[model samples]
Target: MVDTMKAAVFQGEGRLEFEERPIPQIERADHVIVEVGAVGICGTDLHALKVPPGTLSRIPTGVIMGHEIAGRVAEVGEDVLSVKPGDHVLVDQNAPCGMCEMCRRGRPNYCISIRNVPGFPGAPNTYGLFQDGGLAKYVRVRELNVIRIDRSVPIWQAAVAEPIGVGLHGLRKVNVRVGETAVVLGAGPIGLVVTALLKRSGVGQLIVVEPLELRRQAALACGATAVINPKEADTVERVLAETNGTGADIVAEAVGWTLDTCIQVASNGARIILYGESELDDVIPIAPTLIGIKELEIYGVFLAPFVFESARSILESGTLPLDQIVSHRLPLEKVHEGLDALRDGRALKVVIHPNEF
Candidate 1:
């Protein structure tokens, strides 16, 4: 039986209209329909809204647009055994084609057939970017994309697993050693996660650089050894002085295009991770000579790669205060206002309840 449900659809630039759409049903044997309880407004979502029309490649207009999701299974297909109806689950946003070379190499996140596949709404990309996502009452996903979570976990906290998963992958990429000094640029949700993970891993010094006061406080609460407001103080000088002029052992850029700042405060042979979402046309000029002279090893991480489970485990351990990251709990009807809050830096993480009015 088909049913209609309210959804937040993305139009062109800066337009997110709430309208009724069909409630998704189990279409394939391995598919599951999720009754979305909490879906976070991601940095990617905010970036798309701020960019010009057509700049976000292959993302069609009017697609339901939220990927960070946590909810209960409303329906499961005949062959879906991983999760049953009424089970709480965290949705993995990556949708990789299993037949491609990258998939064969176990790098499905870099699935070669992602955009080339036909008949799928987000054929080439992951969910929500080029297809309908979880910012609605219901969303259909493959069984492989859903991970069962403990029923005791709050849905909003489960939703945060996605962003923290990104941080996990990024931190893993750099392999920050224990007792090593680290610097994190930006104090957004992702930055806070990275900071928390670094601290939990026993990093000797965790410095968070942020311009906003609220996020800086959030960073400290998340386990930052020190918070630097770049707007008020010289972040580079502060980091250099704090480390006795050596600089940080690891530097991560959670805010876009902060590579230059990372370079300034990076110690020789420091590893850098760039995981921040940036616009398609955004570019940053960097000194290649400095990178070579300092022997810096730079790494870039995309979507979460086999890190969701770890993120959930971390959340369950009660190390990271996931709820503190959310600044707004908005209904599906006011999704536009939530996005506005993100754009204006008034909110860190805004979660939408599609089932709520």
Candidate 2:
């Protein structure tokens, strides 16, 4: 094995550099060293880079930034038993102390000891931010953080397991039955995954509200029965019109910029799933009176949790065209191209092959 490998290192706000880095080794009994095969560009990665300086103190400059990861096990510590070298795997984004209150309660995404963890502080303990992630030739992760995957699946599709798991987690928690209306706000990668999942679940009518023309078309291809351009039409009125004036039975808020669109389109007793993420301190307007009158049920989805297995199942089922969502592939040196494409709405999902460059 090479003593050093190349990595795309984050150089503070709006900057990323490809440089030589030492290949990580298993330093702990539960640690595993993986040869990163593919890593997907996520909105969160772009958000951190695009945020105002000093806003994301948790993500220090030079932390190799990427979360959606898939790799092959190169080495495993003596205590690692579930996986072996040469196993294909997907790295769980978060690493929680099993004894923490949140982990004990089955919600490790909110681990209370995140700040005390060795890497990044302030946010939950996650790869890319706190530790060197898969935007490199190799990544060092704990054994428990790696999930063994079917080798039959393409590495790029496996890399997206994290985001797909998030979409499945929220869908499993929501109440979307067959022959019902579902409204999805935002047509990004996650939104498209949710749309595909809803369609496979037999959603009778699926409407997507998106301002981007390409994403609106992608949503329709992903199974949305109707696509409304929020810039041209009234989103709420159009949604209500499609639902015959009542409203959608399920509304997935995949855009965290605002809650108004979801709130405005929800029907009486509808389940509104807050699936997207906002800035740590961002706030949106909400009405308590409307919540009471409409009797809306809101669900918050954080990390992938126990849904990675289900996500793999969905991917293997082949119901969703995972390939269509991945629009570009770039070497590590040109990662900025992928990031720019995602930020400018020119691509849906971009995979980075660190080994290539």
lDDT of 2 by residue, 265-356 (tens): 88898888888777667788777677779998889987778888887776666678887678888887778889888878899989998753
Across 1-357, the per-residue lDDT of candidate 1 in tens digits comes to 558988888887767888889888778999999989999988777656765632443366889889998999999999999999999999998777788777889887778535432333334656776678988889999998999998888787888989889888888878778899999999998898888889888999899999999899999888898999998999999999899999998999998888899998999999999977555567888878889899999999877879888987887777887766888998888888888888788998899888641
lDDT of each: 0.84, 0.83
Each candidate's clash count: 2, 0
**Candidate 1 Cα outliers beyond 4 Å, as residue runs:** 51-58, 113-122
TM-score (all chains, Cα) for each model: 0.93, 0.93
